[model samples]
Target chain A: MRETDFIGGFAKGLKVIEAFDEAKPRLTISDVSKETGLDRATARRCLLTLAELGYAAYDGKFFQLTPKILRLGHAYLSATPLPRLVQPYLDQLSDKVGQSASASVLDGTEIVYVARAAQKRVMSINLMPGSRLPAYCASMGRVLLAALPEAEARAILEASDRRANTPFTKTDPDVLMEEFARVRRQGFAVIDQELEIGLCSIALPLENARGRVVAALNIGAPAAHAAAGEMVERYLPAMREVQAALRQVLA
Target chain B: MRETDFIGGFAKGLKVIEAFDEAKPRLTISDVSKETGLDRATARRCLLTLAELGYAAYDGKFFQLTPKILRLGHAYLSATPLPRLVQPYLDQLSDKVGQSASASVLDGTEIVYVARAAQKRVMSINLMPGSRLPAYCASMGRVLLAALPEAEARAILEASDRRANTPFTKTDPDVLMEEFARVRRQGFAVIDQELEIGLCSIALPLENARGRVVAALNIGAPAAHAAAGEMVERYLPAMREVQAALRQVLA
Candidate 1:
């Protein structure tokens, strides 16, 4: 982790890739620089490199990522066993519960979805594998953070770009701290429209045989039909069964 | 696209990311060097940078990609509208057809799955977003290739790592050229046990409003129950309906 070992251009290239999101899919060099905080020259070089490598395409003014960029994520999904291992369980759980079930692991201030099984014609957010949600707001994110040491969890919370995503979102760090404690005490976390309106989700930390938290599992449904407390009363037992079952197999 | 404009280090970093797969997940500097054809010093520096950036984990000797690597793919899926636009259609089509449906776009010699909907307890391939299949053997691959000009398609076939994944796989370049012509004439493609033993699939080009083939759509079922011809007979009409409707909406 020495400073000299870092490849600044490579890191900048990755940051440039992340700078294109849902709100802005096409970006110019100056737009990328503004989004990623890199100099315009550096951003142009990275964007040009991406285009030269076939990961992106530049139409005179703006650079947009192509499907080639998925190859990068494909490497991770193909290499890792977590998604394949949890997929069957996610499928079975989602079918039985008639909702969407997913597995995700914590990464800094976000949770990245690894496996997902969505039931037909129910939920609307349409999260697939490789989707990401902010750690401060998602149910899976809260459960994963609750598994960490209090100080480390607090630091991640402090580092998060905290903002109110919905009217129900708890944006205060102190309020979020208490929610973490509640999750730790209850052995699961629940979010009622904190991420988006009409979405209610409940999550539990999926621990390995050695009791190390490897990922978090959750099932989401529409809040109109399944309230936060109702989700707990109805789905928590089934989710706990899957959690306990996963503990025996996950290494 | 100038060679001087290309950042070699950044390209090498992407190659390093691709070097990890199911058979070899945790790799050392020498293993990566061997896999990517980069020298040991260069690979070591790239690995260290990835570790520092939290994309990889280095436990003294081996460098393993963490789930954080998925953020790279997440950026693409979130930014692109194709997957979101196709999911609802995939859901309805798969449900009506009682099989699995997917959409993909061609990238180099591969077809990367962009969106997928699996009917309950039917498909075994379990292709989610970011999954890749060889463009030579897949039905969707052939349809995508057929949409290209003959010389461009032939060039791609020559560049492909042609191998008999199954005994039924057409490995000869000349034979595949004929198949591409057939696909172009018939307006669709079908594969029976080419990619895998028990899988059968049919694909049609998904043209946009301007009649440009932007992606391929397909439905896959067990080869035993639904032969390749039967799949076309049963599901082709519904798939064509979706394709025609999507043409009006997809601009």
Candidate 2:
């Protein structure tokens, strides 16, 4: 073991960052220590380093993160090949389909909105970049699941404690598995009012140059406005065209 | 001096990350060493640490960043009070104005787009959440510039050797100083075809509950479509309302 080459402090710093989550945006040193399983002294030192780097800020007794830390995400999004290349297409798709469209990649089991285009005065949900939702409940997540190897996808579904977040949410793994199979067979996914009431989404896979499903493009609208037939008739061709254009641009 | 308390490996590891810039997204190990002012061996050790933590990835001989590093930005944006509070208002303002809108904060002498309501069917520029543009030419930059202390603002203006990226761009410092004066007098900024042709923006200050100008809200549109009078008439009220709403939410 290359003990001399180990960088424990960097790991500690990242762990400190990971300890702060959606539920716990602000944390005390004790909270961080408990969350990261690090000692109080180690946690404090990591926080101090993060603060010095302008990543974390202190509010007298409580510690909160700063926007300067957004550089990391900005760095990745600006540098990434998929989001930038796919965003224009998503925009065009949104306009053509008369609905809000988004592109996202799976981050663990959750789908993160990387790029989004929405109609003016549309649905109340303010979808934008960097927003996160449970992957098991989203149309984009289902497309990603359909793209994955069967065993891996099954493992994720088995481990997931799916929530009935809304009245129509799919809480049963067996049922979700059947949905995944349908998605794979149809080469697309449709989730109707599953995550939120009155919302429906249709997702199509976007393959990179290597023909791997690196991301998913989705269009969402109210069920009343977005009839299933309309999505297939007006949106499918353009969505496929955008995917092909993405492959060309990336190629 | 608590030299022993500080982790050199960790500090060095972070320095490697700090070395990346908008100009330099990918770097070789030697480039990292030069940028961080570290010896090659030390840099290599730090890179290994970062790679192990999934923050950095090595692409053959060159080292690049990965999406896992988005955790850093997500942590900050999720925790920060300003962006979280301002985002919904920005969306509402975009809907009301029937145009794209954005909010950015100062980073050194450049303006970074922190939140945006990008429009469908518009030619997607390189501007994303982390993207940066020079402070001298952008409407948002001018609003931010007008807000700064005279000495600090003058220092930035004096040090900047502005480039005329487009025919309408104001490069001369004297001319920019006059523009700044106009913006300060009007309590708003309008940039016409400065950074890019056919692009125009109008920006106004967004004060917090304490009335400190923490950020600026800007509406961007194609110059052909965005008349100055119409923007003021249709967008100004919404912009003002959002500004008020942002302060209330944050408070």
Candidate 3:
């Protein structure tokens, strides 16, 4: 974290690329500068550098990312063992429960999906690998939070600007603390329509060879079809079974 | 390609990440320096910067990429339109043919997979989003190459390291030129165990609204069940139908 050890230009270049999103797929130089808080000349240089490397394309006016950018993500997935090791278990859990199953790890204050197996669509948003959801309301997020030390979890919660995403979302720190304690005691978390209406999910922490929680696995379904108690009764055991098998592979 | 426009530090950082692959997932500082041809001091700085940014983790001895690195790829996929627009067509094609279907765009001398749908496993390698393959030997690669200008195609071919991956692979430039011409005339490319034994595939070019060959789509099946002629006879019409529908969407 020392200033001398960091490459400031490399980080700034990445920030410029990350400025483009679904809302702003193509952007002008001024837009990039405003999005990244960089000067116009700095932004223009980053865009041109990306274009020169074939990672971005300039179509006369606006700059957009090219498919070549996918290689950065491909490199991570191909080298990482966590996603590959967790995929088969997710597939089996999805098949057994007839729902969508996913594995996610905490990144910053959000949970980034690493692997997924879908049987049916249950959410308004498409939950694929690299999809991220808020740690305050997601079941996988809560389970991951529960696995962390109390002080660390509290620090993350304090840092996040919690809001009521739905009628059932718990935005209060005290309520979330109580929920985290319950999840810690039970070894799992069940979120009942906290993220989206009619979207119910149950999540269990996945432990590594050293018995340290590394990620969380979850199954999502419609609330009308699966109540919280029913989810705990039906899905929890299967998730635990997969978690046990996954531990052996991780070891 | 101007010197002032290029950012050497950013490019070198990415090269350090790309140096870690399936062959060597965890690397020491010396390994990274050797792989990327950077000095030990420079490599150490980049690795430390990556670790500080939470994109990498150093476990005492070796450095490894973290899942957070996927955010870079996610940014590209979320901002780009091609992969999302092509997913449904790939899924329908996979469902219809009972095989794996993928869409890829040519990047340099390689083809990078952008979207995919799998009904069953068909090859020794896992073909998923973010996967890369040698363009000279892949069916999708051939279809994409055929769509380019003849001079441009020849330049790419010349730049590639042509190798006989299998006994049936056509590595000769003259023979490959003839094959490319045939594919251009026929509007599709079918390769019979050229990339790998028992792997047969047929591919069609996907055109954007500007009539540019933006990507290529292909269905892969084992040679035992689907012969090159059988694939063309049974799957070509269906692939063409999807391609026609996709062209409208891209437009």
| TM-score, first chain, each model | 0.93, 0.90, 0.96
Model 2: per-residue lDDT, tens digit, B1-251?
Answer: 25555656666776787677556778888998999899998887777777766677787577777667777777766665666567777777777667788899876678877777766334337565666778898889999988887778878887776889788899887788788888889888988788888777889988878888888889988877876556676677778788787776655
DockQ values for all predictions? Answer: 0.81, 0.50, 0.66
Q: Which model, 2 or 3, shows the larger TM-score?
A: 3
Off by over 4 Å in 3: A161-163, A224-227, B161-163
Q: Residue A167 of model 1: what lDDT?
A: 95
**lDDT (10s digit) by residue, model 3, range B80-175:** 788889988887888888888899999888898888876546677666677889888999999988888888888889999898989999987778
lDDT of model 3 at position A120: 48
Q: What lDDT tens digits, residue by residue, belong to model 2 across residues A127-238? A: 5666677788899999998888878887887776688978889878778888989998988888878888777888988887889888898888787897655666667788
Cα displacement (angstroms), candidate 1, residue B30, comes to 1.0
Which candidate leads the pack in lDDT? 1
lDDT of 1 by residue, B1-251 (tens): 56777778899999999999988889999999999999998999999999999899999999999988888887888888888888889888988988889999999999999999877555455788888889999999999999999999999999999989889999788999999999999889999989888888999999998999999999988888798779888999999999998898788
Provide the global lDDT of candidate 3 against the true structure: 0.87
Q: Flag regions of model 1 displaced more than 4 Å.
A: B121-124
Superposition error at A250 for model 1 (Å):
1.4
